[model samples]
Target: MISLGGKPLDIAAFEQIVLHQKDINISATAIKEVTRSYQFLQSFSKDKLIYGINTGFGPMAQYRIDDNDRKELQYNLIRSHSSGMGQLLSPLHTRALMLSRLNTMLLGYSGIHPETVQLITDLINNEAYPCVYAHGGVGASGDLVQLAHLALGLIGEGEFWFEGSIQKADKVFKKLKLKPLSIHIREGLAILNGTSAMNGIGGVNVIMAHRLVIWSTLLSLMINEMMEAYDDHFSVELNGVKRHNGQQQIASWMRAFGDKSKLLRKRHEYLYDKKVTEDVLVDKVQEYYSLRCVPQILGPIYDTVLNTEKVIIDEINSVNDNPIIDRKNKNIFHGGNFHGDYVALEMDKLKIAVTKLSMLADRQLNFILNPALNGKLPPFANAGRLGLNFGIQGMQYPATSTVAENQSLSTPMYIHSIPNNNDNQDIVSMGCNAAVMCSRVIDNAYEVLAVELIALVQAIDIRGISSKLSPATKWLYNGARSIFPYFKEDFAPSQKMREVKNWLTETDITGHFHKQL
Candidate 1:
């Protein structure tokens, strides 16, 4: 069970709740705070003008709303703002979105009723997920349309995905013996006005990106063994001189994973008095930059992923709603806490970093495929006749295409903010777009890694060097090879790639090597 109060939500705990169906409960203090905020807001009537409670939202804030229509106005706001397009978010993403929004409201700053909060908890705990769309959030105004769709489910109006089918939320709520949530004075606006959508999606992406880093490091180690790379590139003595944390950490990981490999050579052993004869052709003094600079290149990415996690977690824990209700101080502060630039910018950086990681994997895969460059491996590591079977040659096309797509998607979404909402929402932050794009890059990167794993294992098998691989590298190689065997013939790799990718995501290869990272 995860407690929602006072403390920030960690990604690990969030994963348990989202992926494992862990139960959730609001803290007693959070309950008390919510009640207090709601009571304070009740003191004001429609006659008394307040930002989200009485007046219209955005530029319409200048107009005063009357008494009877206030509740209807709240309801209408959700219906109007629930405009979303494109593909729907997965159930995992919807649950994460709900969890973030619910946590924000639990801070007791959104003036939400206890019933409203409970309803959100009910949906999450009971595995009733709202169908949140991928588009419709500008990232400023706190993913209005996306969260609005989420809020729509609470009112028993929108569709929900339950038990593997799309059903009416109203019918689902009834079957579950739950009542539709009644909107109160600031409830609808409070739900819609926050950065939870982008933060939630980006939060899960952060976890996935971190996993990708671990996978990249692990895969690079296997490639290192296959290419017989010099161990000096990952030496602690060399990295310590550089004084970069990520570089040093990566170097340490490489040592931990690659040190046991029989194929790796010490730099001094190969470099000292080496001659270039036909029998002793020293074609390379050191590995290429992709193999040699894994630490330097991926080290920064490691730091960036961790840093982005910090910002996203902080956003998840804090209240981002406008006109924050401070009942104790009897004050209301309307500010840009709802702005998603923090999440957007960090997500953009993560996308760029992860895409670069895919490029590294692609380059390394190229090295292992080329006979001239890959330590004299066969063209495509073909065990059979070369022309009859194109080994891993066709696989490179998708990896190259994905890297190109990642580069195109890496354009920063935050800088492309377009003005909307009658200029009231001018200078918006496209955080949701960044979050979506980041997820796409991460998904594509997974395929790239999966393909690279296939090629690397083929290289190991073709070279008949499985006996010489380090324990860790062999474990990963065998784990993958078990699911997808060596491609002696030019069979379609899509099925094999999918199985490998699925296994990688489900297993704890990254967690097992946590100490290294």
Candidate 2:
């Protein structure tokens, strides 16, 4: 059970609630807060009231909603606002949003009844999520349209994703033996009026970005092995001079990941001096820059991941509803908790880091594909002239496209906003849009890592035919081989790349001896 007393929602509990399908429970105090907020709304009929409860919303606020019809008014708000234009958000995202909205309302500040919170909670603990569209939230007036669909489902008016189809809410509620919530004044406004979609998406992203950081570090390890970069670059003294925390972390990781002899041997021997014959040229330089500079390039990405985590954790705990009930102070105030600037900027920053990470993976994959970079391992593209050439050629186009799409999608969404709610909302938060864009960036990054997995395996396979490669390379190589065996001839690799990406999700690399997880 997670408490929601104007504190950040617990994201790990949410993950278990959805991924593991856990039960839900609300605190007694949370139920009281919602009751107090509801009572406060009921007490203020004669005073100049808020537009959402007794008056019309947005441009229509000039017209007052009648007391007898307040319940209908809230339902109408939800029905009208369910005007989302795009496809539905994925089931994972929809479930996350449902839980987020429930947790947000538990702060007891949204003037909703305890039953309302319980109703939403019932859907979640019962493995039910209201079907919400992918678009229609600007993030300023609290994800408006997207959230409207969620509210619509709660009131038995809209549809829900059940089994495989979008079923009418009433039918599903009955079929699943669930109780439908009775409409209350301003319940729709409160439910659909916060940054839940943006927050939900941001929560998932925190996990995805964290995974990408691990994958990028592992990819960097693969490149480092192929490049034979100077272990001295990872030396404690070299990084301590700058005192960059992330740099120090990267260096430490490199030190742990490098050849065991590199740490023990007092004298570093150049392969050129020891092994290279008179046939080589250009100093037979130690691996390309892509492989050599991973710590320098991706160390900052590690720091960005850390910052993104802080943003999500802070947002999760904060009460994001308008018209918060300060029952402790006996004050009812409506303000700007609906604003999504906080989540949008964090997602934009995450996208930027993830974009660079995918590009880095693609570059490393490129080096592994080339024999010159692989160094006496395999031919360019690593297919090894099956008949003549095949595997590498087909895979290259997809890798290139993934990198380009990531670059294009990383353009920040926070800087752009369109006024909505009839100028009442003149400035908006593009937080929901940021979530969508960031999700796309992650999809693109997944494919990039997939291709890198193929290339890393190939580089190791050819190198290993003679002498065993670094222990780290073998770990990654064997891991990839389990899911994606070496391709000696032409074949479709889309399936293989996907397998590698999924492996990273469940496999804990920190448990392994090698750094290339």
Candidate 3:
């Protein structure tokens, strides 16, 4: 079990917990801090006018709530705000959502009861994933409605997904012998008022983005070697002069892949290697931009994914709820820590980075499908009678369409805020939308990469030189070929591409290479 407390939580461990369903617990010090903060908040009276305590929320803050109705007010707040609608988030996103929110409360400033904190932890430990909806989170005031839906499940009032089926929260709670959570004053607002939803989505996106970068580098190296492109573009002498760390790293990775190749040839020595049966013609003095600029294009994507990961890590460890309780100083501060602008901007950047990577894959796919540019390979890598069967000719359509869709989805969401909550939130951040868009872009990029990998592998087979492929490329080629049997017919490749997408996401592509190396 991973214990969360005063120390920093790494994203790797966080991923293990959320994606792998590892158990987690609040640290001892965090439990104490939660109790202290809750006791301090409990000391407040009905007339004290703390935000979301005895006073109303948003534009309704002017209305005062009586002591007897404070609990009802908090309960009603959750009931009304649990208004999210749309397709539900996947179980992984929902699990991350709970973990992010729990991490926020564990900071000991949200004034949430320790029991409620444990309740959330228990939900995660039990693998009880609430069905958080996609819509209703403007990301201005902490994803109010989306988180409220999460809170609704905690109180045994909404639905949850358990054992691959949707069931009522009450029934699941009863079966698990877990009591329904009670919402005291300020607890409802604390739970619903934060960037947990966006952070959760952002967290998953960051992981996927990281994978995409690695896959992009691997595929680029594979394509480069397959085309027998000049290795000077990724040479240390050229990239080292730029003083760019990302470039240096990608160049080094390319060298590792290229070092094992028999196909990588110097420009001047095309006939020296005796392994050649056919003299591959050198048509151009220099490779095209897509083939030559892998490091340059992927360098920024690496930096962007890392930068976004840092932002999301900090957001996960922060106390983003309103009315932060200063237990030591006996003071309260009400501010918009709940604002998701930080994650919003980073997610937008991630979408763009992943989209560009997808475009690179699309460009490579286009190049390899054209006989003129593909080192004399058949058009679309077709080996059969050209008119009787089309090999990968039709597969390019999905890659092109996804690239176009990703281009449209890359528009930033931070600049398009509309006023809501009676102008209390005059300028909002559509962070949730940015995160969702990032997720879609990542998925699209995966499919594009899958298609590119399939097409490249087919090209390698068409060349009829399995011995010429580098060990690293051969490993990837074998791994992918295992899942997606080499295409032999003209049927649509959609089903095969989908299966490959799943395999790529689950199989640690780069990690496998590292282990083999």
Candidate 4:
């Protein structure tokens, strides 16, 4: 179980709750703080005009609301904004959204009632996900529309995903023996006015992108082994001269991966130790840039992913709602804490980094498929009779096209803001769009990597070098072959490709090399 409120939540613990379905325990201190904040807000706002408690939201804040209709006002805010339209977020992402919102409230600055916290906790533990959408949030003023749908579900009015199907919120609540969240003061605005939606999606993207990098690294090493490429490029002596931490770390991993391999060659052992040879050497002196410059290429991607992780973790632990309710300081300050620029910028950088990784995988796939380039392996690595049968040729089309699509989608969403909400949200952040697009890019990269993996194993089998592979490469080869056995005849590869993709998504190959990032 993951513990909240006592210590700040990090990415690892967040992953445990979202990906592993671990239950969360709210701290006693956090519960007391939530109660204290609620009481303070109730007493302090009785005679004062607060942002959402008394006045209207956004441009309507100039209007005054009477005490009699204040509860209805919060309800109106939730009901009016429950206008999200598009595909429903998967249960995984919806659960992450709930967790992100919950963590922020647990900071005890949102002035939310203790019951709100308990209800959200129950929903998460019971795996009843709100039916949030993909297109409703512009991410300025914090995923307003998408989170309003979440708020709608909390009030037991909208649809929810339970037991692998959509059910009405009231029915799900009844079956779970739970009560809907009652609007005490500002639960509606509090739920809608935060960066949780984008933060949650971006958090999952970071986890998957980190895995994508490790998979690309392993695939790069395997390709080098297939070609018997020179080891000097990833050698410590060569990469240490570069002043990048990512470069050095990637080089270290490559060295470790090739430690016991019989296929990797030392340049000096063949060239320097030997006497004068033929004027025209048959071996190519250096490899293509994709094979030789892996450390340089993937180093920036590694650094970007790490930086993105830090920013996302920071956002999740923050109080992102407006009108900070500081019970300790006995004050309420209004501002734009709900803006999502931090998460937006990080998501843009992350998608670009992942897109580059996919480009590398595509290039390596091309190198192995063309005999003119690698000087080995038949066209498309076809193991059957030449020209009579095709091997993995059709898979390359989707891989290349998918990489092209990722390149197009990598256009930054950070600067694409359009003023809306009656210009009240001028200069807004399109953070949710960025997070969603980044998710698509990560998903596309996985497909591309899956195709590359299939090609790598096929090349290994064609070369008859299974015995010479490193232990790490052999593990991958064996695992992949088990999923997609050796094929020499022409057949449709769509299903086989998906099986490999699913395996890549579900398997945690990073742990075999080092601790997960």
Best by TM-score: 4
Task: List model 2 lDDT by residue over 1-517, tens digit each.
Answer: 5444544456566656655567777877778778887787666544656667778877787798777888989888889889997788887788878877887777767777678888887777666678898888899988998899998888887788877778888888998787777776678888888888988888877777766766676667655655444556667877788756777787777666555522122215655247656666543344466665667777787788778777776776677877775666667676888899989998998899889988888887777766665565555445556547665657777888889988989999998988867788898879999998998898778778877777766765655531344555556667888898876776777777778878875564544444332
lDDT of each: 0.87, 0.74, 0.86, 0.92
Write the number of the candidate with greater lDDT, choosing between 1 and 4: 4
In model 4, where is the ten-residue run with the lowest total lDDT?
508-517
TM-score of each: 0.96, 0.90, 0.95, 0.98
- Listed per candidate, the RMSD to the true structure in angstroms reads 1.8, 3.4, 2.7, 1.1
Report the C-alpha lDDT of model 3 over 192-278, residue by residue, as the tens digit: 999999999999999888888888888898888787777888998999998878778888888887777987767547544444465
Off by over 4 Å in 1: 44-47, 272-280
Position 459, candidate 3: lDDT: 88
Candidate 2 local lDDT, residue 122: 76
Among these predicted structures, which one has the highest lDDT?
Answer: 4
lDDT for model 3 comes to 0.86
> Model 4, range 81-182, lDDT digits (tens) per residue?
999887888899999999999999998998889999899999999999989999988888999998999999999999999999999999999999999999
- With a 3 Å backbone cut-off (N, CA, C), the pairs that clash in candidate 2 are 7-317, 8-316, 8-317, 8-318, 9-316, 9-317, 369-381
